[model samples]
Target: MRTIIGWAVLLLATAWVGAVEIKRPVDMGFVPLRAVSYEEAVELCTPLLSKDGKLTYAKIKNLLVIHDYPENIEAVKKLLAQIDEDPVNVRVDIFMDQAAQEKSSSFDVNLRNVRVEHRDGHTRVDGGIGISAGQGSREMSGSTNPFIMAGNGRPARIWVGETVADPVWVYEYGMGQGWWKQELVNRDLGVSLWVLPRVLPNDLVEIEVYPRVTARGSTPLSVDVKELGTKVVVQNGATMPLGGLDSSRRDAYRRILGVGSVFNGSNLSISVRPTIMRMPERLRQEKARQDQPPEKH
Candidate 1:
C-alpha cells in the first residue's frame, strides 16, 4: 500500500511541470533541503517542482575585491553600482577563468554579515548563515564556507564567482519486499527530503538536503550519494554578502563556493555537490592577463 501511494505522489509531481520556456520577471522561490539519511531527502524530492512546470535561472555575478589595488576603493564602489544599477542582469568582470566558471544550479541564499579579517598572517574570513527551514544535520562536515580571494590573503582580494546546488528528483521502484528472515541487512544511504509549498509567487522558500549512508561494522560498502544539492527562493531585490571558510592554498585565506567540485569522503562514499564558478569573470581576467607585459621574472 505504501509503495502504491509513493508512486501516486511521484506521478502527480511530474504532471505539475509546465512544458515551456521559463519567463521573467519570474515568480521564483529558493528552496534549501537537508537530509541525514537518503530516505529522508528523497521523501521531499518525489514531488518537487511538479506544480510549476516552468523553471528559470537567475544570473548572479560574484565580486572579488583586492583592497590593495590602486583601484580598490573605486572597485568596491563600482561593484556596488553595478549591483545597484540593474539588481537583475548585474555586470562585474571576474579576472580569472579558473576563478569563476559555471556548470549550473545553485542553493545558498541566506548569506549575511560577511567580512575578511587578518589572523596569524593569513587572511581569515568569518560569516554565519541561518536556514529558515528543514532541520538539517550539522554532522555532514564539508566546506559550506565561501571561497576565499587567495585562500592565503596574498595578492589579497575578496573574489566572487558563481556557486549553486539545486535538487533534481527522487523516485524509487521497490525491487522486492523486505525478507521476514534476512541473514544480513545494511543501509548504505539513509536520507529524507522535506518540501514546503509556495503560498505565493514571491515566497522565501529554503530547502536543506544531505545524504546519510552507513554500513554495519565489517560490512564492506560502496555507494555514491547522488545529486545532493540546495534550492533557494528569495524576495525581489535581495542580495546576500558572501565569504567562505576553507583553505584554498597554503598561507592563503580563501573559500571556494563555486560548483562542479566534490566533497570526497574516505568511507568508500563520495558526495557530489556542484560548486559555483563564473564565466564572464574568467574571460575578463584572461583579457587582462594577455594585455599584461611579459613577466620580468
Candidate 2:
C-alpha cells in the first residue's frame, strides 16, 4: 500500500512538472500610447510601418506621443499627412495588456486608449480603429461546395491573357461564407494567383480555379468544371501561391495578372492590392529545377 501511494505521488509530481514546463511567458498587453511631442511620436512609430505602407510585426517598445495641443493640431495633421504618405512605417499606439494580446494573436493592430490633449482641456476618447491579422487557414465545410463555376455548357479554359469578372466565393472557416462580387480573375501564365478565404499556419488546402464559358446556340449551361491545385501555406497573414516565391511575389503576381488581389484573414481585415498581369517564368523554371531529383554533378 505504501509503494502504491508513492507511485501516485510521483505521478502527480510529474504532471505538475509537465504543466509548469509548458507554461509560456504571458504576452503583456501592448505598450500603451502616451501623449508625446509630434516629433517624438513620429520617431517612435515610424519603424512600425514598412516602406510599402504596411505594418511591421515588430513590437513597439516606446510610447506614442500625439501633440494634441490645439495650437499643435495643424502641426500634428501635417506630421500625420507625411506619415500617411509613407504609411508603411507609421503605426498608431494603442494600450493592451498581456491577456488581450494573446487573445488577439492574429490581429495586426490594436487600439485601446485614445487621449486628446488640448490647451483648453484634455479629453480621453474611447474608440479607435483596430486591424487584426489575416486568417491563415482555409477549410471548406458545408452542404454546398465552395467553387467557382463557368457560365457556358462548354468546358471553359481560363487561359493566359483572359479576364474573368465574376462573383468570387470566399470560404471562411467557422463564419458563414460570403461572396465578393466582380472579382477580376486573370489567368496569366507564370503569374501568381491570390485566392480568398485566408489560410492558417500549417494548414493544407486544395484550391480550385474555374473558367466561365457560354454554350453555343444560346442553350443554358450548368456551372463549369474546376481545376485543382495545391495552395501555398501561409506563414503569417500573407503567402505566396506558387511554392518557392518570396513575400515580394505577392506584388509581382498582382503586376502580372492585371487583376486586383484581396485577402481576408481570421481577423476580418480585408487587404486589397491593385492588379498586375505577369509572373516571371524564370521563377517557375527555377522552382521546377529544384523540385526535380538531384542530378549527378
Give the local distance difference test score of model 2. Answer: 0.33
lDDT of 2 by residue, 1-297 (tens): 999999999999999998885563321112222223335555655554323222112224232332223324344345544643110111111111111111223657777666665555755566687886664543421111121222111122223333334445554455566645444443323332323322222532222222222212333322333222333333332323234333344333333333333321111111221111122678646644543432334
Residue range 1-297, candidate 1, lDDT tens digits: 999999999887776653333331223222111111223322423333233223222213122212222233343334333432211111111111122222343354586787889888999767977555433322222322322221110122233322223233344445774333323333333222222212123333222222222223343333333223233433323432212212222111112223223322211111112122223657656644543433323
Give model 1's TM-score versus the native structure. Answer: 0.16
List runs of model 2 lying over 4 Å from the truth. Answer: 24-56, 59-297
Candidate 1 global lDDT: 0.30
lDDT of each: 0.30, 0.33
